[model samples]
Target: MKQRHEVFFKQLEGMRNYLLKVADVTEEEAQIVPKGFKNNIRWNLGHVFVEQYAWIENLTKEEVDFPKHFNEWFGWGTSPDDFTAETPSLEELKPLLKEQIANIKGTYGDRLEEVFEPTQGMDTLEQVLLWTTFHEGMHLQTILDIKKVYECLIEN
Candidate 1:
């Protein structure tokens, strides 16, 4: 189990680096909804952080480390239209995503032996983190797609 956790930690480093690359967009670009997409780059970026925090904190029944009322803006079904307060800028979202990766690694790296029961077919913290890296990768791909569309918009 410890070795498995160690492997995922390295995988997470790749995720962290990919997310940072996805986040390199202007605030305006982040909010632009390309014609075929329902969400903007900004929304997807924040969603990644929201998911990591929600899965870990919810399962552990521990206090989440995100900003105040983050779920209101970034939860699974929440969207920019649902936001009642100011959301973080692209600049702000990037670092928060980066910080969450560090928090997860720092807090759990040595403790993967700690077991939590299966919820949604994930039987342990390591399983959740493992799945989350793939989840974040999907969103990073979405961000990249959005950027490609944004580029088309720019070229036009």
Candidate 2:
């Protein structure tokens, strides 16, 4: 039978849809750092993907990592002003954000109850999925706030 945590993917899908709605914009738009904000929509988009993957890989003692550049560009403590020539455009990040969700679904949908041997407390696949969902939800709200500020700045 399919893993019981299908609801987790459903929640992620809702979060993904909301994040896409906020992150949908030109590369130039996604690059804007609103007056009080350190990062923009693009950073949050990449972050939502990176942090989830980071938790799974780290907590499970798995070797999987996001692309090398993801840590540099979107890792915690990263800021939008740190952009280098190699920073991904919103166009690039948008699809990858969705792909992250789809990849998680494919990887964990049937295996959520499978033991993540490295974890002793809250180490189950279900807990990882749960934590990732909460993290994504937080980022979704942050993206919404950033988008509003960015849009306001654009207008005035």
Candidate 3:
């Protein structure tokens, strides 16, 4: 792997670890849609997982493996209120998130600079991966906010 690609992978792994740490709440807490929030910790977790796969699929034109119903449960514009079935718990999601960086590196580490027809204005796999990282960061902030709300609620 190139040095830059190694750095990118390490950054991704670090960010994912931090996100998992921030999500250290009970399953019940993960399900709590704090007042004024559109979704809960669980929803944000699932969305990040699904969104990464969706972006990679768009770039590679290849299907990526993820749990069934993840798209319906967590896709963009989806809400927990719309879920028709039970979704993965934090326990399930954490392992998937932990493994995702390794999988991404193994699958695309050497292909980062490879160019493809533009998707969402991104022509390189690296560009799409950067965008996905930004997307994950945004949802990580949401999870932190939700965690704060849950903590306050418990204190009250």
Candidate 4:
């Protein structure tokens, strides 16, 4: 693996752990709110998985094989309210997260040199890795905010 890929994997693992910790709390207080900018805990988790899956698929051209609904619920071009379907429980998401991470490691670990191409703006795999890390970090903050709402709802 390249240095950039290695660093991205480390960062991804850290963020995944952090998000799970936050989900543990949020899942305990699951409540339906009438309105909000943030998606619920389940939506947030699925979003993380699907986004990573999207990036991996884009680079490797491998099918991620996530459930069909996930594509509509949290796919590349949609936002939280795009679908009216209920979100899955956090317990339901843990396995998928593990599987996705394993698939990414397996497929990309050896194929780094051949996997990515410099596109219109990005000129290297390192740039793609950096973008992916930033994407995960952005969602980490969103997860934190969602956790705060969960806490407030529980307290009220």
- Predicted structure with the largest TM-score when compared to the true one: 3
Most lDDT-accurate candidate: 3
What lDDT does the true structure give each of the candidates?
0.79, 0.77, 0.88, 0.64
Q: Report the C-alpha lDDT of model 3 over 17-41, residue by residue, as the tens digit.
A: 9999988888888889988999998
Q: What is the lDDT of residue 12 in candidate 1?
A: 88
Ranking by lDDT: 3, 1, 2, 4
Clashing pairs in 3: none
Worst 10 residues of 1 by lDDT: 109-118
Q: In model 4, where do residues sit more than 4 Å from their true spots?
A: 1-7, 26-38, 77-87, 123-126
Q: Is candidate 1 or candidate 4 better by TM-score?
A: 1
Candidate 4 C-alpha lDDT tens digits along 1-156:
678677777776776776677667445543333256545566666777877766656665567676767878777666646656365666877777756655666766655556355453664444555676677677667767766765686689
Model 1's TM-score against the true structure:
0.89
Deviating ranges (above 4 Å) for candidate 1: 1-4
lDDT of candidate 3 at residue 120, scale 0 to 100: 91
Candidate 2 C-alpha lDDT tens digits along 1-156: 354466667777887888787677787777777777778888888887788888888776776646967888899999877778898888888778878877877866776777766543666777886787788788878777877886676689
The parts of candidate 2 lying over 4 Å away from their true place are 1-3, 117-121, 154-156
Listed in order, each prediction's TM-score against the native is: 0.89, 0.86, 0.95, 0.73
* lDDT for 51 (candidate 4): 75
